[model samples]
Target: MHDIDPGWAWSPVEESQQPWTRQLAAHLYRRAGFSATSETLDEAANKSAAEVVAELVDGRTESEEYLAQMKQLGRTVVATGNVENLPAWWMYRFLTTTDMLREKMTLFWHGHFATSGDKVTDPQLMVDQNELLRRNSLGNFGTLVAEISRNPAMLIYLDSVTNRKAHPNENFAREVMELFALGEGRYTEDDIRELSRCFTGWEIRNGRYRFNRYQHDSGRKSILGQEGPFDGDEGVAIVLDQPALPDFIIGKLYQFFIADEPAPPAELLAPLTIEFRENGLNIAPVLKRILSSQLFYSPHSVARKVRSPVEFSVGFLRALEGSTDQYALTSGLSELGQVPFFPPNVKGWDGGRTWINSSTLLARSNLIQSILKNKNTRFSNGTLSDLFDKHRLNSSQEIIDWLETMLLAVSLPETVRLQLQSKIDSGSGNREERLKEVVHLICGLPEYQLS
Candidate 1:
């Protein structure tokens, strides 16, 4: 990666270098959003990579009808007052929503500004926070930081619901610097103390954020070489103004959209960091540049990320045009580790290799098996066999090739491909069951675990 030129890496790929193809389209869709269906991939392959990425980044807004449906579903879940149901609600959106990049970015922000339903308890507040993340997912970073600072779910989760002046809670302050904006070691302990004082009157009352001036500490404080009686907003501005903020955020984004291992060198990230900083932290442009870049379509990023549990399951369902009981799906996701609103901790899921272990790997295979076995699971509103027939996948080779193209990020070994063919030819049960078994087997492989 260090050997790659920063300018050429971020530049658009030429047709001579990498012609737009279904495989490249699949790579873009997998990294940009959840995976796309083969039909979608075909449509995307007809266009230039720039055109496809422009569509993804520009088409951030969901249609009014889709928004209404999502809003109604969210309301229904909140009405039940059960946070457990929220994951299913989001899973439904993940499967059905057309505005893929927005949803994907919302998921990214959910991990970045990690807040859990485990502590917040209020279903409405949690739903509101989810919406908050979605609304600002592709917008201004400074604005997102400002809005999330006063978000009730975040306040409650961070134990800053009542940050009194007498004993200011340092939780939000420390996290705002360490996790949210600047990376760790970018700010000092004294900075956290002073920043916490700035947020002293912030509280959550009646499920909304409120500031009680009486509890605020009005004393002058110094933070990050700036002196002022900074309120929470100003304190956030100061933190966002730090020199390290761009590198920190761009580094994280690189890991998310590019690769998970072999942390990007400072030189490689310099171009993106400058773009992000110059654009006033507008996320869409940076994303647009990254998605259309030469490096994004190259070997470095194609299969670099390990699919998180959400990506693993959601990508499969989306790619196959499959649907199933979302509640059961959410349960399976929980068993596999990522539970939407219920993140494991403030640090979120450690993603990458951490997603796979002996137990979770087994759970992942079992989850796929359970989905395949469930009568409710359907592909294109019918059985898997019917869907495959619709696509005219008659021969074992055609079916295996199609599965390999749509599902796996990396190419299967020749031996593995032959093994899959053998299963399709001789596995137990009817053809549908045999095909399903082959899919299950493929998903269980180490290759399928990658994004």
Candidate 2:
């Protein structure tokens, strides 16, 4: 296998005449956004890999109307005081929004930061944090870390608001080092204690950040070999300055976007980490490198991750070019063990193979079927058969191939492909029923579980 080039930043790979094949476009979409639509695949097939990466990174934007709608929905949720509905609302945006990459990164950061509404219990605060993450999702990492440190949802969730001069709560401090910035074993107990002291008096007042002067510990402290009378924000900055920070973040990004089971070795990530740090922790550049790198298109990285429930549910709907009740999708995702605002715990959902179990797998299948069965699900601006008519895909074989391209990340075995083709050919109903049957079978397969 070809190793990822260290100079992948500016070096464009040689482009073939057919550079943007359906397979490459599908891989790009699955990793960078959700799965590709037929329209997106068609458009991308005409562009080079570099152009596709650039556009996926910078071309998309959320519309003002969508922003207004999201604000209204959030206001409604906040007024109702049911923070639980935030996930359902987010699913609505995910289903309809044009800016897929932003939403995708927001989801990634949600998992990376791993704060839950279960702890905060304020709908508005959770909504605020979600927006903060989205705004800075592709922005600078340093600013994001500093802002998240003071985010009301985070302060409450990690007990940082309770951290004070006399009695310091180390939960937030420990997590900042352990989970957010640096991985475990990179910091000491002394670091956690000192960082907690630095964060003293950082409290939430009427749903906003308030630093209580009386509760603050003003004494000098030493953390990570630096001594100062540092505040919470400064502490975050100091931690971000650590040399180990880049490797920790890059590895996690690799796990999320590339392979997960057999973690990428440190040697493979060293060059990328340098680029990440040199670029001032702006995620877009590193992402551009990864998405455009030779290693990304290699067999070792493709189809290497299991789709999170959100990915499976949202990507499935997007692929069908269909729409459904967001409430149903939300409930179905919950059954699959991932609610948007409500991650199971601080560590968030354990993805990968843990996404699939006996019961959850059943729930996944039922959810896809329910979406397909929805009366409002239109393909090609009409019914499912309209999809066939619009695409000129009439035969059973062409329909199967199209569905496979849209749905499966991994290749199906020849025997399994033959069996599915047989099933489609043997169907008694018309093209719609045959298409649905073939698609349903494909979704239920193990291959579809992987991204």
Candidate 3:
């Protein structure tokens, strides 16, 4: 189950110790974000998977750099100041970004944690929260939740600060139980009431956490059939103890990192939950265990899940030394339903089939056309042909190779290849237009959707 299957028709596994190892690492890194430099990919790929994964799973504290980012980000007490080039620059970061796995994992947490800039109403606060998500993305799941639970940004976004004693607001608590923590059906209305009380005094003041001693309800209440006047942290502690917590979280993590359909056996996940809870919510060890599991590398895992627009866009641009016009890139992503920094709701954009539709397909094709024409919005007669031949890809086979790598994690079948070649060889189609057509076809295909 080592994720090795020679019959699958992927390019042969270059020997790990060979110079191509870096090339392989670059490939994986590119899938996560920007393309890798030879040196960068070599550094990542040279390490054994264990070593590389360890680096990815852990996090570093760059307080000095963080303070700089914070200072540069600039904050107004009003929380709605406009940012300049930094917004576009961040998009660039994701495209040319390093720390490949961290970026990917942080994106996963963004969906899991699920907050939006719209409700938060403060770009800087949202940015801070985003950085926090990235910083702890792979390190610890429980810690991530705990910090997010009290996050001033989250409080404002979900109206948690509005929660009070005379009437406990269940908005934040319910989501914490239903959406974030135990999934759904694991906790009930009564549990929600008690949880809300525990968070009653957990308020945000002038953009900082200010627990109100007066508003706090110290009175006992039952949660998940357990009785207590459990405060906020204690409430989280209690919820984490549930038998299903790990299964819920582990299942989610599995979907993000491995096959979307992969499920953790109750036995495997139970122990993982216990280990996570016992380890102060540190997620690194838990993920190390998960990734190291024999089941993780099962044949079903590789290239199984569909890449999101962010993944597809970033990965393609990295591999092809590609960049797109700023607004169009944003527009293309918007049309695809995965705009960065603008998640749809607190739940974020749902993945998988939701990413595709007739509208989205047109948007993707247009983006391809734009890339081909050096930013032309409309296709001219034979304009695509001129562009392809201009690139000097005289041989139809070269076009096929470019499309294959640019569009797939692996090669396509010979039959598919021949069909594309035939399309290219057709006399009527312009070479550049045909090239664009080929890329468009591949991008539109089902296989191209998968990683």
Q: Write the per-residue lDDT of candidate 2 for residues 1-451, one digit (tens) a residue.
A: 1354445422444332234487888988888888879998889888878888888788656788878988998899899888888888898888887777778899999998888887778888999999999999989999999899989999989988889899999999999999899999999999999999999999988999999999999889999999999988888889999999999999888888877668766777888899999999999998888887766776667888999999998888788787787887788888899999988877777788898899999998898888778776666567777877778887767877888889888788889888888877786777667767777778899999988
TM-score of each: 0.98, 0.95, 0.78
Stretches of candidate 1 above 4 Å error? Answer: none
Q: Best to worst by TM-score, what's the order?
A: 1, 2, 3
Separately for all candidates shown, the number of backbone clashes (residues 3 or more apart, or on different chains) is 0, 0, 5
lDDT, candidate 1, 1-451, per-residue tens: 7798998899987633678889989988888889998889989988889989999999855789889989998899999988988999999999998889999999999999999988988899999999999999999999999999999999999988768999999999999999999988898999999999999999877888899999999999999999988898899999999989999999999999999999989999999999999999999999999998998888889888999999999999999999999999999988788999999999887888889899999999999999999989999999888988989998888988999989988899999999889888885779888888889999999999987
Q: After superposition, how far is residue 325 of candidate 1 from its true place, in Å?
A: 0.6
Q: Give a tens-digit lDDT track for model 3, residues 1-451.
A: 2333323212223322233344344445543344443345547656764565566556442356655654564443224464332244356556544466677777778887787755676666767787789778777666788889988888887888888888788888888888787988888888887889999888977777888978888899799878877888888878877867776876677666656554535554455666677876677777766554433433455466777887766665655445555556666676778876667887877786677688877776666556666653322223444434544657789867755654565578899889889888897755556766776677667667776
Which of the two, 1 or 3, has more lDDT? 1
Overall lDDT per candidate, in order of appearance? 0.92, 0.84, 0.66
Please tell me which predicted candidate would have the highest TM-score against the true structure. Answer: 1
lDDT of model 2, residue 374: 76
Number of the candidate with higher TM-score, 1 or 3: 1
Please tell me which model should have the higher lDDT, number 2 or number 3.
2
Ranking by lDDT: 1, 2, 3
